[model samples]
Target: MSGARQFTDRADAGDRLGETLRDRGVDADIVLAIPRGGLPLGRAVADALEAPLDVVVAKKIGAPGNPEYAVGAVASDGSVWRNERAIGGTRTDEGYFEERRKIEAENARRKAERYRGGRPAPDLAGKTVVVVDDGVATGSTLRACLSKLERSDADRIVLAVPVGPPGTIADLEAQVDEVVCLETPAGFRGVGQFYANFTQVSDEEAMAYLER
Candidate 1:
């Protein structure tokens, strides 16, 4: 994929991604998207693959004083993925990290519960689980979601996305059984850069995708 190329929206990207997966003969028992941006794409992928859609939630652990910058991320199940370089660069101590981790983990748990609404988590045992996302920049939260999946009984784990930076996508590839990224663009600044309509997805809209 060209670094200069852009997607029309999440739906267009999802359609293309689903076609790519089919072309590669990839099969999925379930599609787990990282919400809330991921849900839109996951819906298309789920329809294309004729699989069920669900969410995997995670919360970013921001750097000290810079809440927008992620030092790490924690999944709903307490699985964590830390950016050691970010932590060291920010001079964040263990105490701060632990405190933030606990807080953010609980946040993630609540969000997941809210999204699922009273439904139980899907069983992944002996199943092919394809994890979807809109796009990845630093991939802190996505990594945390992958960490949680790694601890599951899934027979296979695949990461799918519309776009990502080369380095970040490459790093994520090592963590999954297979990766189906449509674009690994050069000079990547952020995930929204590759999309024409990158509006923020509300919790209500995100949850509706699962209901479909």
Candidate 2:
């Protein structure tokens, strides 16, 4: 077979992703990594591409009764991507939706500010933007992030990740110019399955990645 074909960790996954992007002649003006888990991979990708590293934050709007189950997501600038299927199926009430939207939007804004650390947000206009995330599961948050980038007028948006299911990747392809994913295997589990050292990244640890 062709080796293990799985990542040792987020950093290893990012190294492979960076190599893939480079081999494909992908060029980017900036690399925007989704905060928390994506920061490590984002740092590696930015270093590989010789581009500035930045963050794009989005908060999941969880179902009222099920806080972990996302009904939608809102980006830092209040741009939103609703999981209409889930919302209709769950029949989420207007009061819950509005309340969660406001709260999550504010949370996203604060996270964006923290990641930027006084640096003026980069202008995405007329620029090829590379968006990095460790891996996607439900894809709600990533969709919201892409929607925010869409509103910001990024010239071209490329979504890069180490592993995601084929169907998820296909759906994302409609939202971005290119989707660079390393493995799309069958019998998909959580993203953590593809990594060996899938440690929980602390807030301080994540912020440190942005600094470097």
Candidate 3:
């Protein structure tokens, strides 16, 4: 990436991203943010688009012996996005992947239920949905969420983020109707590198953003 930081914080990044979406005349019926970090940005983006905000939950299926390395991801609705390259490189077996997928899918479903707090899931049929995230690296979780949306009756699906690597961005473009990424830095390391204050977001704080 550039030597200078791209954003002071997530809120700042969200403001810029929201502005960019507005300038592009992107219409959204609802904004679904990946919980925790994405909630803050989703708030700003929802406000900008004049739409309701909600969370689209997914959990990363980490590699064996290297839990931080994601081999795939599973969405709340059992939608999955597997990284064939990562699976092959990590030598993740079919049984292992299937077990993890079931576990993670249940985890994601529980999270979505908790985040929704008993409210019915959004009616996405024929509606334009925008999926927001703080940023992405491998984008496993995002791909899973997008997969869920793709299987839904949504009229259109848009993926929006603050920054990501070029290769990941290009791959994501094929999965959605449109992508609204503010920055795609060449020398990317991780999403936090582009922000000056990349603090962890709590579930409590994340849920608050959905309160309107």
Candidate 4:
């Protein structure tokens, strides 16, 4: 994906993603964005599709020594995705994984509540769901989110992201019903590098998207 237009920010990425989805006639009954960054994009997608926007929460389970490195992730309902390679490579103990999973799951649940604000969760049963994100890297969090959705009654699960690495996009294709990624460049490093104004989106700023 050469000469791709750099995203001005998360909102710009979301706008582009919305246009792509609309062009494909992607009809989503609901749009769920992973919080803190995905919200901006989710808002655009929901508006474009004329669907309701909501939050889907997940937290990374970092490795033992490298707290920044995600070994896996867990969703609000305790649905988990574990990176066996990361665990084995780092010799991450079972006790450590267990502890983090529990903690992260709880954290995810809390975040979801905060964003939704006592609103009952939208019924995914027999509904078309589009999970929007700014981008993807290792895809640990996304895998966990998909796993959680699989356990639900969602009729279809489509993942729509603005950009992602080719390898990660390939792997995720097997997990979801469909993938709509605008850019799948092999030269991907981090998600931030593709954006001209890739700023850190605070929880306060992220939550505002949900309110609107």
Report the number of the highest-lDDT candidate: 3
Candidate 3: how large is its RMSD?
A: 0.9
lDDT of 1 by residue, 1-212 (tens): 55543898998999998999888888999999999999999999999999999889899999999998999999999999999999999999999999999999999999988999999989898999999999998899999999999999899999999889899889998999999998887888888878888999998999999999
Which tens-of-lDDT digit does each residue in 1-212 have in candidate 4?
77444788888899999999999998899999997778899999999999999988889999988988888899999999999999999889999999999999999999899888899888899999999998999988888999999988999999999889999999999998999998898889888888888788898988888888
Rank all candidate structures by their lDDT, best first, as comma-separated numbers.
3, 1, 4, 2
Please list the residue runs of candidate 2 whose C-alpha ends up more than 4 Å from where it truly belongs after superposition: 1-5
- On the 0 to 100 scale, the lDDT of residue 99 in model 3 is 98
Q: Write the per-residue lDDT of candidate 2 for residues 1-212, one digit (tens) a residue.
A: 12333889889988999999999999989999998999999999999998989999999999878889899999989888888888988999878888898999999998888777788888999999999999988899999999999988889999999988889999999999999998887667778888888998888888898887
**What's the C-alpha lDDT at position 27 in model 3?**
93
Residue pairs with backbone overlap in model 3: 1-187
TM-score of each: 0.97, 0.96, 0.98, 0.97
Worst 10 residues of 3 by lDDT: 1-10
Per-residue lDDT for 1-212 in model 3, tens only?
Answer: 46547899989988898999999998999999999899999999999999999989999999999988999999999999999999999999999999999999999999999999999999899999999999999899999999999988999999999999999999999999999998888888899988899999998999999997
Q: Which stretch of 10 consecutive residues in model 2 shows the poorest summed lDDT?
A: 1-10
Candidate 3 residues lying further than 4 Å off, grouped into runs, are none
Query: In model 1, how large is the Cα lDDT of residue 209?
Result: 94
- For candidate 1, what is the lDDT? 0.92
